[model samples]
Target: MTDQKFDIIVYGASSFVGQIMTRYMHEQFADESISWAIAGRSKSKLETLSKDIGLSDIEILVADASDESALKMMCERGKVVISTVGPYALYGDTLVKVCAESGTHYCDLTGEPQWIRKMQDRYESVAQKTGALIVHCCGFDSIPSDLGVHFLQQHALKKFGQTCSQINMRVAKLKGGASGGTIASIINMVKEAAGDAELRRQLKDPYSLCPPDHSFSARQRDVKMAYDEEYDSWIAPFVMAAINTRVVHRSNAMTGNNYGTDFLYEEAMVTGKDGRGKRMARATAWGMNAFMVGLAIPPVRWLLENHILPKPGEGPSEKEQLEGEYDLRFFGKTSAGDKIKCRVTGDRDPGYGSTAKMLAQAAACLAQDVPEGAVGGFWTPASILGDKLIERLREHAGLTFDLE
Candidate 1:
């Protein structure tokens, strides 16, 4: 809207997830008419990606997220900025500020609750005043989880004559690998756990993901999530813990709590193989909890921080995450026998594959084609775009959210 030089500008397009976003952009707009460019801190890596990804004709721009002037210049050139750089707490805030200050809408594939929440507090007011809609968690941690629940709530109102008070999402069947960037994110999270006790605790509160009084539709129920034996399948506790569920709730809150005051939410991964898989998943979760707790310890935290996770300047290879995939199922039910369920299946892995599509479309849609008057400022993919993003996903990416 500001007469920017480009419709959209992608930041960190040379990083692990960023490269995938760049490729998606190539395939999606190969012959289309879209004024866009790839940008990163390194012109060489950007050029190499351009050659490797077969986008030699496309121009590559250089802008380090840490460099304020360069970042603001990039933001000034695009109606929206799509960011793929992450462990966002470390390298993201500066761009977010620039986008907000420049009135350039922003979006990213971030599942890090601590960082998302921090941005809301530090930039929400500025974003609101400047008309920048800063959206995070556009990927697996909550896109499907967030958008899927929005579908359930809408479906409930239309058919059940009542909104669901509780909804449960589980991993039905999935196979995938992690990107080095994803690995780097996990390692950094572990290291952060070692340093900040409050962050680990804040991530537990479902309402903590958004700005205060934002009214997220659901809340984290303090109950042991387990498999449903009656379904004859194993369902382990949710992997995202409060991250995904809280985001969905935040969407609900941001949308005026349209679902209801007493909405409930939880999510999990699927397990089977005579329930052995479920047991193993539970065991794995137990280990993860222990590891997170261990990371919080003084001596253990120091060792993990220094030896395990890569330092800020390092991360995973782009090739690895692009090869991964993630699938999920969300089952919603009413107080009676009424029931409805949906599945989120992605062609790419959740961390990278699915995220690439989600992030690219997020910026493109926000800039080029999204319907007008969708509430601006900090938002969830569903809360702002609602069916708008779902349609984009189906048309632009091999993503599916089907009801059964």
Candidate 2:
């Protein structure tokens, strides 16, 4: 084991979300002997952040995410790095390369599936060889979705002696806000990859989530049944459902492909609106769905590129993002009358605040606690870290993973 200077390094520490994570770390480990520092391209931004968060106790390093040499140097200084760089396709792959090459474990809060697929193909072998555990979706998009499946399946195994045959994650209700940074990242990814057919294909390919052998069809299970009598209501599409479900599938793929053996998995929204309002919401979902589907076409894609999306460096206010919250409830069933219900709740805003905390805890676990000789490579949040991350989130992040 390397006697690294810091247990964990928060890369991109100058960004809005990165600043939150850095402050959390400073608060989390104010007096620990384990060393840590902040790294980013702008020393001034980092200095400003340090002052804002009163992190005079922690060291700060200047390292650009785009600078390969700087990233490697940063990776060398810490056992693990939690990167908050957005869209990741543009600024992330380089950092992954550096960390994988240097044998430092890495974690990120990225939701760009295509970018993630690209990194897996390019770095899987190298990461395996270097013993770098490059884990992704350590945020709202996938954490609860993946771990929710894990927790439910574990219970199913314990109760019925069989894995959950089907899992349905429903966002019963949500009251939250989003960040400009989060919005910027999403638009950045769309603008960056919308031009490349191959990249877009990689993003949409379900099997491409991991290796071919890791593929599992989430739609195989029947999801059209009426909602449970308790929360009986019509469901609609979750804005982030696409990203979250894919993460769960990837999680199952990483864990020997057994979580959903012969199981179908999906996520949906529990539209709080009912009656006429629910009908309108459903119609709106149809329109949104139509729009998303149309974006797949070349001409429509072109229009979105030219007309939509904010330019680079423009994203959400810290206050708005920090105030957001998310609630996820899942339903699981087996053929043998075994039923399970699980929920994952996050307190901080989904796009920025909660995501930052989720990522920080994930990286900190890998840095300060993950056992040596454990499997290392590209993995989803749940598959790579398992209960360790769940526990830490509860203890440190105020995030809850409850099974009932």
Top TM-score model: 1
Local distance difference test, each candidate: 0.74, 0.75
| Candidate 2 residue lDDT tens string, 192-311 | 666888867766655567576754655343233234344576766666765776777777777777775455777777765457647745665786667666555667766655676443
What's the distance in Å from true for residue 381, model 1?
A: 0.6
Model 1: per-residue lDDT, tens digit, 81-134?
Answer: 888887787889899999888888888877777778888888888888888888
C-alpha positional error of residue 128 in candidate 2 after TM-score superposition, expressed in Å: 0.6
TM-score of each: 0.89, 0.88
